[model samples]
Target: MFTSRGPTLRELAVQALSSVERGYDLLAPKFDLTPFRTPDRILDETAEALRPLGPFRDGLDVCCGTGAGGRVLRALCRERAVGVDFSAGMLHEARRAHPGAVLVRADARALPFRPVFDLAVSFGAFGHFLPRERPGLFAQVHSALLPGGVFAFPVGAPPHFGTLPYWAMLGFDTVMRVRNRVWRPGFVMYYRTFPLVEVLAELRRTGFDVELTPLEGLGRRPDGTPRCAVVVARRRA
Candidate 1:
């Protein structure tokens, strides 16, 4: 769902026809008005969960579009916070909104930072990384953090079997597959590609000690399982 000020269907269509970087650039101005922006509820919960991990001196937000997640960093990190995104348009909008923080335009796959940050986080951006590319992405984050620093993000519980949301996700991924098959400069986002199990495995392979914290604000399913969780992957000390 989108706001009245958000991208119109025609604008969204043009964005869908572009590469991921270009599409996000086109969406940057109104990204927070769309459901695609990471919800504030999740951001607040993640900030609370990460609070005890602080006196962090410096923080980085990986793939930080419009810098909503950077607020979490500002709350948790005592010293400095920076938001990094490959989309220059997104970085520009984020800089205007969050002038207190630094912004960088760089691909997450090959971050330009040294082991400088005490913590790093990303939100709603994993789908942009193809499954095969996740390892490299995680490795880059690992390398960017100080030895004991963390790389965290939220992940929702998979929709139940036979549910409408499940079928909707299936359809979305199928459409993405078809679009990439027929088009150049692929938009490359898919809902079902990153499962929690496989993601934990990748984090471990990239030398993280991973853990999950239930995001209680998102509630739970009928089976009493969490409907959403914040996956906190700590780089080994």
Candidate 2:
């Protein structure tokens, strides 16, 4: 459900056909209005969950689209906070909404800062990165943070195998696959790419001490597993 100012059906159609960068650019103006932006409830819960991990000084938000996670950084960090994203449009919206924070336009695979931040967080952006890209991405984030600094983000549990939500995600990925096969520029959002087991292994390979904390706000499955969890990885000293 989009807000009153969210993208129109026509705009959504246009974005669906465009590459990820170009689509976000086109949707940037109305992005906050869309359901695509990370929900405020998640932000609130994340900030509260991370409270004990602080008092953080410098913070960085990787692939911060329109500053949702960046706002979390602002609360957790006492000193400087910066948000990085490759989308000019998303960064533009982020700048307008978060004037006090510095926004850097760059690929997450190649961050510009070095041993500068104590805390780093990202949300809802890993879908854009292919699984092959995780090692490089995590390494970049690791290189940017000081020793013992954290890089955290939330990951949702896989949906029921045959449920509507599961099928919906499957269909979306199928359509995206077809679209990429037929299109020139590719859009890289997948419903299931970063599995928790593989992700933890990659983080370990990238020199992070990793742990998962259950996020109770999203509730649990019938099996009693957490519906979502925060992957908190600390850079090794």
- Which candidate tops lDDT? 1
The deviation in Å at residue 140 for candidate 2 is 0.5
- Candidate 1 local lDDT, 1-237, one digit each (tens): 877989999999999999999998998998889999988889998898888877798999999999999879988888889888999989989988887678889999999999999899999999998999999999999999999998888899899889999999999999999999999988889998898899999899899999999989788999999988889899999
Q: Candidate 1 — worst ten consecutive residues by lDDT sum? A: 95-104
Every candidate's CA RMSD: 0.9, 1.2
lDDT of 1 at 137: 93
Instruction: Point out the worst 10-residue segment of candidate 2 by lDDT.
Output: 1-10
TM, every model: 0.98, 0.96
Show where candidate 1 strays beyond 4 Å.
Answer: none
* lDDT of all predictions: 0.91, 0.90
RMSD of 2: 1.2
Q: What is the per-residue lDDT of model 2 for residues 127-203, given as tens digits with 9 covering 90 to 100?
A: 99899999999999999999999999988889989999999999998988899999868889998888889999999
